[model samples]
Target: MAVIENVHERVLSAPAPAVGRLIDRLGSDGDPLWPSPTWVPMRFDRPLGAGAVGGHGPVRYRVTAYEPGRRVEFTFDPKIGLRGTHTFELLERGPESCLLRHRLVATPVGAMRLLWPALIRSCHDTVLEHLLDNAERVVTGTVSRPVRYPLRARLAVAVESVRLRAVPVPEQAALLHAALPRPDLADAFSVRVPPGVSADPQAWADGIFRNPPPVVAALLRLRNALVTPLGIERGDSSAFDTVARTDREVLLGVDAAHLDFRADVLVEPDEDGTTVTLSTHATVRSRAGRAYLAVVRLFHPPVVKAMLRRAARVAVAPPGPGARPEVAVAHG
Candidate 1:
């Protein structure tokens, strides 16, 4: 086993007690220092104190010691094989200043020994630095220099976004359920909306339709070309009409000679974060419709997955001055 120790410290222009208060609220509902919405949040079964169990993301640990506004320590779960402890401490430097520090002492066993230096360490270092930046921003009203996510960290987040799952259409999608009482096909795919993104389903739907990826755009063009010959309507933004909408869900679809299709976009909020589900329903009206459905069924999953993933990425990104205008959804 190889032991790896890492430490990060920052001097805040605030009193030790004030800085320590932030530590006490590490996993609380309105945490001002954990750098969430961009990364997995810190959470515990109860609250922040000795014996409280929780961890961020895939890392699991239990609080072993707590000193309220001074220091807190966590011991890793043995099953993870990264045997060690990590802690946060506040040291008073002066009447109006303090030093905040975080340290990780772990011995990686088996495969983690190799994985640590290559991947985990970079992500760990980045997260900690961002935490410190958050502390500076909250206590001092600004960060001297905010930490930009490196390529590796951005890549890690992108890869993690791809881990979506198929799900039954949510109850919130009442509009879709009513529209397709017994459709020829019904399927849903869901992904967690990253922390800090808009909870409006319209925002998520715009991400899916307004600026689709190149591959998805090409596929749609080919689809339109193939279907136009058979008198089927093209699936484009202009063809879609918002049939029904609420704050949490929006239903959009198009009708054609061969079939009727609708998509339900629903945003559900939970403790972890918001989850955006895209549920699609289709009703075939003829033999040509059935043949089209057969071919589409094969490509539906991947296309929907790609579209949802792109929406998630767009939803989390910081908007610029020239950001695209949001797509409008009709009321009622």
Candidate 2:
């Protein structure tokens, strides 16, 4: 049997007990570990202890040993292609310093050897680094060094960028009404404006889609190039229809590009400024929807950032003739 071993460790600027407490809660519900933006966070069926069943993403495993605040070990299910034990341990180096470590010892049988080194290893390295940084933030007030994406993860992101540009525009919305929660995967953006500025939610939506920011215009050009060749027609601002409205909330429905999206524009007035939250809920119902979304997730943050930046511009820019009256003065 060929055995594969891997280990990652970091020295935290906090005491062992502090590090232990964070480790104990790793995969349990309410786990505080910040997940890698590119992958699913770990989840456990129960608290860390012997016989607990849980894993991250598609991997499944069971706890083989446990020591609260000290160490815990997980043995992967053979079905996952790796027969091995992975353990998390904390060691006190000083009264106020501790070493946090993850050690995995496994035997790769069948096709796992290829999968482990190529896909699994890259994902594991990136996620583990993030996990350690999260622990450091918990122990210390801040992380001295933030997590940096490895080469492989960066390449994955580049591939995602190209795919986003190539996505086709759907002619109509998918009729599937099964709405999922705001989705842990959503990217959100917000802007604050002084209460005196009264921007009409409808007007804001109209401007947002009608005159897109430069970043968005570039994306649209890419989409147009791809769709034009396929003979698929493009949609305009008319595609964003106001479906629901209230004094404080406006929901604009969108049907475009293989996705059904609801843009929720919420305004909460305050003494200092009115806080605006622009949240977009999206769903894709194709047979490859899951895979499509995974790729989309990598690109979601940039989309939100561009939209919010543009909306802020719209709110603050002075009205020209019939220009949407400058209603909200944006604050960073």
Candidate 1 ranges with C-alpha deviation above 4 Å:
159-162, 193-197, 286-288, 316-332
TM-scores of the candidates in the order shown: 0.85, 0.54
- Point out the worst 10-residue segment of candidate 2 by lDDT: 162-171
lDDT (Cα, 0-100) at 330 in candidate 1: 15
Clashes of each: 1, 1
Q: Give lDDT for model 1.
A: 0.81
Query: Residue 74's C-alpha lDDT in candidate 2?
Result: 92
Q: Of the candidates shown, which would achieve the greatest TM-score relative to the real structure?
A: 1
lDDT, candidates in the order shown: 0.81, 0.63
Cα RMSD for candidates in order: 4.1, 14.6
